[model samples]
Target: MPMSFYAQSTVQGTVTDAGTGQPIPGVNIIVQGTSNGSTTDFDGNYSITNVNNGDTLVFSYVGFVPQEIPFTGQGRINIVLQEDAAELEQVVVIGYGTTRKKDLTGSVALITAEDFNTGNNVTPENLVNGRVAGVTINTQGGPAGNSEIRIRGGASLNASNDPLIVVDGLPLNDPRDLSNGSRSILSTINPNDIESFSVLKDASAAAIYGNRGANGVIIITTKRGKKKLQVSLDSNTTVETLTDKVDVFSANEFRSFVQANFPDRVDLLGNANTDWQDEIYQDAFSANHNLSVSGSLLGDILPARVSIGRSDLEGLRKTSKFERTTSSVSLNPRLFNNHLKIDVNANLNFEKNRFAPGVEGAAIVFDPTQPVLDPASPYEGYFEYLNGSGFALNNVPRNPVAQLLQTRQIANVRRYFGNVKFDYQLHFFPDLRAVLNLGVDNSTTKRFEERSTQSATGFNASQGDF
Candidate 1:
C-alpha cells in the first residue's frame, strides 16, 4: 500500500513575548513558503499539521518582529518575538500626505480590508461603519436600496446632501445622476475590485479639491497589478427570500362575498369586486455575478486589470425585472524608464428594464348598478364598441380578463454608456508631482413601448421611441 501524504508531517509551537516571558495571544504561526497557517490561542499554544521535517515555521505578530526557524523533525518548538517600535512610527496615508498615528492633528480613522470585506451588499459608507467618528450611514429599504452619507453635520439647507465620490483622480458624475427616483451609481460599482477608500471630511483636508468639496470626498482606489505573476478569484451569491407579497383577494372569495350581501343583484356586484390586481402580481428572485483578473504586463513595462460583472434582479411584483451588465479595464504603463507614467482606463455598461401593463382608466366603468357578462343578452359583456352604430350598454363594463388579454402593454428600456480617460504623470522634481488629464464620455438612451388595440373599450395601440 502507498503511504498517505498526511502521515509524514506535523508542526507544533508555543509563542511568548521576548521582553517579559508572558504568553502572547493571537500570534499567527505559519509554515514558511506556504498558505497553511494557524493562530495561537489565549494561552499561546498553536499546532500546525502537515509540516515535514525540513519545512520552516514562521512566527509573526503585528507589533513584533517575524521570526523564521528551520524545523528539524522536532515535536515541539518554542519562539519569542521582540516588539518592534518602528512599526508604531509607520505613516498612514491621509488626504494630502502620510502622517504618523500620534502626530495627526486632525481626526482620521483607518479601516482594514478584512473588516469591510464581510458584507456582500456593502454601500459606500458601510466600509467606514464603526471605524470612524461623526459619520452617519443610512440605507433605505429594498434591493435597489439608497444609501445616504453625512459627514461632520451636513451643510447646505435646500441643496443636495449626498457626499461626493471620487474614483482614482476623477470626480464621479453626480451620485444623483442615476437616481431617477429609483437607481444610483453606488449600487453598480463592484466592491470586490475596490482596494481602499478614504473619506475627506474637514476643510483642511478637502479644500485642495475645491467647490464640490463642501460635501466632502470619498476617494476610491481600484485594484492594480503587481510586479509578480498573480491571479485571484472572488465569487459571491446571495439568496434573498421575498419579504412580502402583494395584497390580493382570491377569485372565488371576491365573488362569493359580493353575492352574499346583495343576493338579488349578485351579478351586478360581481364586476365591481373583480380581482385584477391579484392577477398581475407574483413573488420574484434576484442574483449577482462578478469576475475579475489582474496581472503584470510584459514583466514590468505595464500592469493591467480587467473586470466584468452582471446583476439579475427582479421585483416582488411579477411585472418588473432589471438587468445590468458592466465591464471595465485599466492599464498603467511606464515610459522613459519609469520617469513618466501614463494611465488609461475605460468602462462600459449595458442595462435593460422591463415591466408589464395593468388596468387602465376606462376600466372604472365597471358599475355595480348593472351586471357584467349578461346571460340573457346575446352580448356577454355589458359594454361593447360600435354596438349598432354608436349604441352600447350604459353602466357596466366587460370581463376584466378578456379586456386585459386583448389589451397588452409592454415598457422596455435599454441604455449604453461608457468613458475613456488618459492621465500623464510627471516626476521631474522632488516632493512634487504633476498630472495632465483628458477624458471623453459618451452615452445613449433608447426606449420602446407597445400597446395592443383594445377593440372592446375603444382603446387603440401606440408605439414610439424616446
Candidate 2:
C-alpha cells in the first residue's frame, strides 16, 4: 500500500437564517460519519476539531432545514439555513391568530368536521360532545332548547361561566334575547355547515377577549366554497321517547298507601286510576334537512357556498314544538395572484317555537285517583275543585293534562349574522400579512302567550304578546 497521511484540522463557522439573516443559536453541527459534534453559541458561531478537510459538515436545527456541506480545505465557512415548511405547520385558530402547535404553550383543542359526532344533532355543541379533552357539552334538554358547554369547567362563582362564542369572527350573544324561550345560543347555525371548532381552554389562549373569555373561548369556523362544484345534503329524522319514568306511586300504590296510612283521607281518592305522567309525556319526532351548493365562480376567481336548512323539532312533552329555517351565503376569494384574500359570509335564520310550561311538578303530585274528565264540571270538562259557587279555586294546582292542552305560548324569531374579513399578504415577505375584520349580528323576537278560559290557573281567557 502507498503511504498516505491525512491531517485533521479544526473547522469554525457561523450559522444564520436565510430569510432574516439573523444568527441562530443552539444549532447542531456534526461531522459526517463521526461522533464529533458541536453546537452554535449565542452568537451563532461553532468550532469542530479532529476532522479532516474532506469530511462533510451537517448543520441541523428545529423549524429549519438541515444542510450538508463538504469542507474543501476552507479554513472558515458560513452557512444560511432556510425554514422547513413541514416543521412549521399552521395550527388551529388561537385568538383569531394562528401559530404552530409546537410554539403554543396554552391548552387548545381543535375538532374538525370529520371528528364530529353523528346523528340528528339539535345544536352545534352536540356535534362536539365528549370529543375533545377538557371540554364538556351538555346537550339540549328539550326541542331546540339551550345547552351548557363548559371548557375546563367554571372559573368563577359570581360572574358568568359561559365561554365567549365566536362564529366566523363574530361573537354570538347568549341568544336568550333572540327568542321568547331563548332557546339555543348556536341554534342559528346549521350543524352540517360547520367546518371546524377551535376551543381555547386556558387563560393564556383566551386572553385576547379579556374578561369575557375568563371561562374560555369557543371559535366556530363554517365551511367555505370549494374549487369544484359540489352539492351536499344532510337529512335525518330522530324520534325521542322517555327513557324511564320516575319511580312515583302508581294509581293502586297511591290508593293503598293512603288507605293504609290514613283511613279518613281515603275519601280524597276517586274511583278512576289515572297516571298523570303518562298523560303528559308522549313520543316526539324531529326532522332536519340541510342543502348546500358550493363551487368556484367568476372564472374560478370567486368561490361561493350557499346553503339552506330547516328543522322541525318536537318536544317529548306534549304540545311543545320548535321549527327553524336558516340560509347562508359564504364567499372566499383570492385576488391579485393570491396576494389579497377576502372572506364574506352572511347567515339568516327564522324560528318559531311553542314552549311547554313547568308542569312536571303537578304531574307527579296530582292525585292519581281522580278521573281526567268530568262531563258536568264547568272547567272544559276537566276535573277540578269547586267552591261554594261551583268555581275553580285560585290557590290549588291545575290538572297537568288540562294545562298543556289549553295553553299556547309561541315565539317568532328572526336573526341575521354577517361578517367580512380581508387579509393581505406582502409580496416581498410571504410570512408577513395584515388582516381586517368587520361583523354584524342583528336579531328580533316576537313572543305571545294565550290561555283558554279553563276556570283554572286563570278563570278567564288571557293573552299576552311581547
Candidate 3:
C-alpha cells in the first residue's frame, strides 16, 4: 500500500533593500524568536511550511539592517540590519593596558571561558592538566585531593620552595607559613571559585615580583558578577577504595606462624590473631558542595561575593574518622573614579579528627585467642603452661582485652587565615599600581594518649608529650 500527503498552500518570500529595491543575497530568514526558520539563496528567495494564519516570519542579514514582517498567513517576510561600523573599534584588555592582538609584543595564551567551565576537573591543577605545554600537574593518590604542580621544573629545595602566588596585584602569604606537619596550605582553596589563572614563567615577565619571582608567579582571578544576576551550583561525590593495601599474614597464617615459632612459650603459642593491618584500613567516601552568586552592586556601591564549602571524609577503619568544613566571604570596593581600591577577604576552617586504639601500637601485640579479663571468662594462666612444638624459648603473650581497653588517643587542629589590601594607581605611570598587602595565619593542634597499667610502656607515660 502507498500513503500520500498533500500541501494545500505554499509560503514564499523575497528580500530586497527598501531604497534600492535590489535583491539582498544570502539573507537569513527565520520565524521570529523561534527555532523555525530558513535562509535566502543568492537570489534572496526563501520558502517555509507548517506556518498557520497570522504567523510571523523574520528576515535577517549580517551586514545590513534586521527587520521583521508579519504574515497574513501568506508567509513572505523581509529584514534589514544596519551596518554596525562600531564593531571594528573593539579593544581587548592585554597586559596592563588594552591593545590589539597584532600590536602586542609579548606572547600570551588565552583560554576561553567556555572551555574552563565545561572541563572535567575537581581542582585548578586538574583543570589545566593536559592543556598547557610547559605545565605539569600531578596528583598523589585520591580524587578531589591535593595536587603537585611544576612549571618547567621545580625551584625550591627545603625552605620556601613553592612558586609565588599573587591575587589582584597582592602577593600571597608565605608558603612556609602553611607547612603544618607535611601538608601544603594551598590545598585548602576550592578550584571552582577561580575565574581564570595565568602563569608568568620568563624572567622578563616575572621580574616585577623581584626576589620572590625567581620561582615564577601564578595569578588567580576569582569570578565576578555581571549585569544580569546569575546563579550557579556545583556538587560532587566520590567513593574511593584503597589503591594498595599492606601485604601481611592473614588470620590463619598469623596463627600458624605464632604456633610454629613460639612452641616453648605456651602463652604466645596458644593466643595468636589476625594481622593488625587487615583490621585497620577500609573503603572511604568523600563529598564536596559549593554554591556561589555574583552580580553588580547597584549603582556602583560595591562588588560583593559570598561562597560556602564543606567536605566530609570517613575512612574504612571502623574507629577512625576525619572531617573538615570551611566558609569565606570577600568584598572589593572601588573609590574615587576607580582610581583607588580596597579588597578584603576572610576565611575560616574547622576540622575534627577522631582516632581509636586499633591503628596505634601495643594494641597489635595482644592475642584474641587468649582469655580476655572479663568477669565471665575465668582467668587461665594454667593453659598457658601447655607446651606445643615449634615454639620460641622465651616469648610471652600479652592479654588481648587489656590491650584493647587500655589505649586511648585523640587530636584536633583549628586554623584561621585572612588578608586585606589597598591599592592606589599612579598618575604618571597609569599602569603602575602600588599595593600594601597584610595577612595573618594561626593554628593550634592538641593530641593526647594514655596507656593502662598492664602495658610494657607504662613507665614512659608519666614523662608526657613524647
Which candidate's TM-score is highest?
2
What is the C-alpha lDDT profile of model 2 across 1-466, one tens digit per residue? 4222357778888999999999999999999998999999999999988777678999999779999999777778899999998645746888857777657888888888878998888778889999988888776567867877788887778777889999988888774443444577787678888998989999899998998888899999899999999999988898989988777888899989998899999987888889898899989999999999999999789999999999999998999998989999999999999999999999999988888887899889888888889897887899986666677765677888889988999988888998999989999998999999999988788889998765476673222111
- The model with the greatest lDDT is 2
Stretches of candidate 3 exceeding 4 Å from the true structure: 1-132, 136-148, 156-160, 175-182, 253-275, 316-322, 333-342, 352-466
Task: Give each model a TM-score.
Answer: 0.57, 0.78, 0.55
Cα lDDT for residue 45, model 1? 90
Q: Which candidate model has the greater lDDT, 2 or 3?
A: 2
Residue 132, candidate 3: alpha-carbon lDDT: 56
List ranges where model 2 is wrong by over 4 Å: 1-90, 175-180, 460-466
List CA RMSD, all candidates.
11.6, 13.3, 12.8
lDDT of 3 by residue, 280-317 (tens): 45577767778877665865657777777666655555
Off by over 4 Å in 1: 1-112, 117-143, 175-182, 233-237, 244-281, 334-341, 355-429, 448-466
Native-to-model Cα distance after best TM-score fit, residue 314 in candidate 1, in Å = 1.4
Could you give candidate 1's per-residue lDDT for residues 1-466 as a string of tens digits?
5455644567666899988999898999888889988999998998888877677888998768899888777888888889876755655445554466556565554454655736555344556666656677776544455577787777889898676776655566653653232245565465666776667777766776777877776777667766666666555556554454345445465456667776775654434444343433345566667787777888788888888877766654444566667677878887776666677766666655554334433334333233334444333343342243334433444544445444433323233223333323355554555556565444444555443333444442122111
